[model samples]
Target: MYAPQADTRLLARALHAERITAGMDVLDVCTGSGALAVLASRLGARVSATDISWRAVMTARLNAARAGQRVQVRHGDLSMPWFGRTFDLVTSNPPYVPARDARPPTWGRSRAWDAGRDGRHVVDRICSHASALLRPRGVLLMVHSSLCDAGATLTRLEDAGLRASVTERARVPFGPVLTERLPWLRAQGLIGAEQDWEELVVIRAERS
Candidate 1:
């Protein structure tokens, strides 16, 4: 399971900032520990959460239970559990870190944050299918590393007829994963030779 980190906190801040009215239907995709899902419930929204990792699903469920929140935690790929159901809001902190391989890992802890090659493996999928999961005027809030091309994300969402833009951003020092892949990241022209920080962005896309 992916641990909640800066990206998670940032997304949570954005969630808290949102005026989530009571009974709003919220779905959190790739929910790690279900922190955001629980928070949504706390804000009076009915919540559901999904994660590719069974461990994460269980963890989220446990967390929600302990918090006395009613969150339906499910084990599934991003947004898969909610097919044919549209939500008022969808939030994700998906795998956006670039990895050496061209394909994402099918199993293991790395699946939580390893986006293959250009780091759009999961992001692109989210962009394409987001519209299907959103009710008209429903919103999607996603967070990822700027290294994965945030502009492309905006364009993709806009192309799908969603008004999208960066809602929040922050610069954080490289974590263990990025620090370990410095040479490769630099070689790929994803970061500056002397750079040690990465900018994380929260994108908000609204379906018309």
Candidate 2:
């Protein structure tokens, strides 16, 4: 039971403006509702999308079918099975909510929103494999809450030898986070107490 929410419009704009063309290889990791993959298919790209959640995978397939597009949606862990497959483009909206109990209720307590105890588990893994997943000159696009450390993400990606940048920023309200962890984040200097409680960021990077 998924809704028809499409890929974030900003993401669509980036894809459209970029070099994605017919017959190019692409993968939309996370593939929630398959919106990005569907859009890629419409651009004539041979797209494959994967999600760990069975419901999300099925929903993506249904969404692609509804749009009369052919996107290969598979139920698999991020970047598995297709380990050796490099792509012209890879995208994801990873769970970066820092901690399971540290997010607000608007994020809905789903595993999809939580990023384990540190909120970096999924994203860190994505960055770890990004270089190997992309073709030469290929790109990786990801969005995460500012609650997570965007800089660290970029740093790790760069360490992997990929050219990374913050391509976009949006002040979307993510609702709220657990109050108990506030002191820890502040003490760790990861976030300031005066910082706005709700915000998200989108980052785009390219593989060398």
Candidate 3:
């Protein structure tokens, strides 16, 4: 059962809206079901997508077949050894939930949720590596949660020497984010322990 997540589904649509041109070498990290990869391919980018889950890899391939596009899908972490090279445009829609987040009953067991105790584990790691993974002047488009400290994310990218910017933001319905992420959220004074996941931001950064 493919569950439709706001971040996942919304990411593909946002990518389409970004008007990414043809022939761009795009890398979709944490590819999950490959929605972003397939969409980028349709826009004429040479796409390479990867995920940490086997099921996600299969789903991505299947979805690509249904969409009549070819995307190189691989089962791997943010980057694999064989994925040895870099790309012109790197994008990731990674898990932003902290460990306290109650595992969603819907999401099939995948590392796509709960980065670490802070929810920035994988997010920070991926953003930190973006510079090495991207070519000079390459771009990185990523979507994460305000639940994950959007400011810190931007700071990390900047620390990595990438000029970062918030391209979009939206308020969506998130039920458990308030309950499960409350402890950490309140610890950071991010949430009042009464607020849920209402806002998400799509970030765009470039390798300078």
Candidate 4:
């Protein structure tokens, strides 16, 4: 199971800054461990969380129960379980690591961090579709690494007719995944030989 990390903590901090209120509808996509879901529930939002992994879904449900928070946990692709529904707020800390493979393992813990070659596999999906899942005046708070191209995300959200901007950012040292891929990433020129840090950024998009 994917445990809470810097990206998760950063997203939770950003959600707190959103000032989520009681009864506000909140959806947490790719809700690994349901860290964000629990945080939102604690803040009084009517929270729902979704994950493609059955393991993650069960883990999230258990975490919610252990935390004494009521969260609707769904098992499916990102946002798929919420079709025809709109939320006041949506938050995600999706897998944004640029992986060596075209897709993550079909059944493994790697699903929590492996994105396609450019790491935009899931991020692009969220950028293109999240706006459609939001109610009017709804806001989406998503966190990803700058290596995934934050500019592209901003542009995509804007193209989707949502006002988007980077709301929070934190520099974090390379975790095990990135550290393991350092050689390949350096060969690809995605990172310099001396680079050992990645900047995590939270993008906030609002639908008018």
The positional error of residue 57 in candidate 3, measured at the CA in angstroms, is 0.5
Enumerate clash totals for all models, in the order shown. Answer: 0, 3, 0, 0
Q: Give the Cα lDDT of each candidate.
A: 0.94, 0.76, 0.78, 0.93
Q: Point out the higher-scoring one by TM-score: 2 or 3.
A: 3
Model 4 worst lDDT window (10 residues)? 102-111
Q: Write out the backbone clash pairs for model 1.
A: none
**Model 3 C-alpha lDDT per residue in residues 1-208, reported as the tens digit of each score:** 1354777666776677667787888899988878888889999999998887788889999999999999998877677733568888887888777665444223456355766666787888888788888899888888887877889989998999999988788888765544655676678776665665568788888887
| Pairs in steric clash, model 2 | 98-119, 102-178, 104-176
Please give the distance, in angstroms, between residue 112's alpha carbon in candidate 1 and its true position after superposition. 0.4
Ranking, TM-score, top scorer first = 1, 4, 3, 2
Tens digits of lDDT, candidate 1, 1-208 = 7678999999999998888999899999999999999999999999989999999999999999999999998889898887778899999999999999999999998998899999999999999999999999999999999999999999999999999999999999999999999999999999998998999999999998
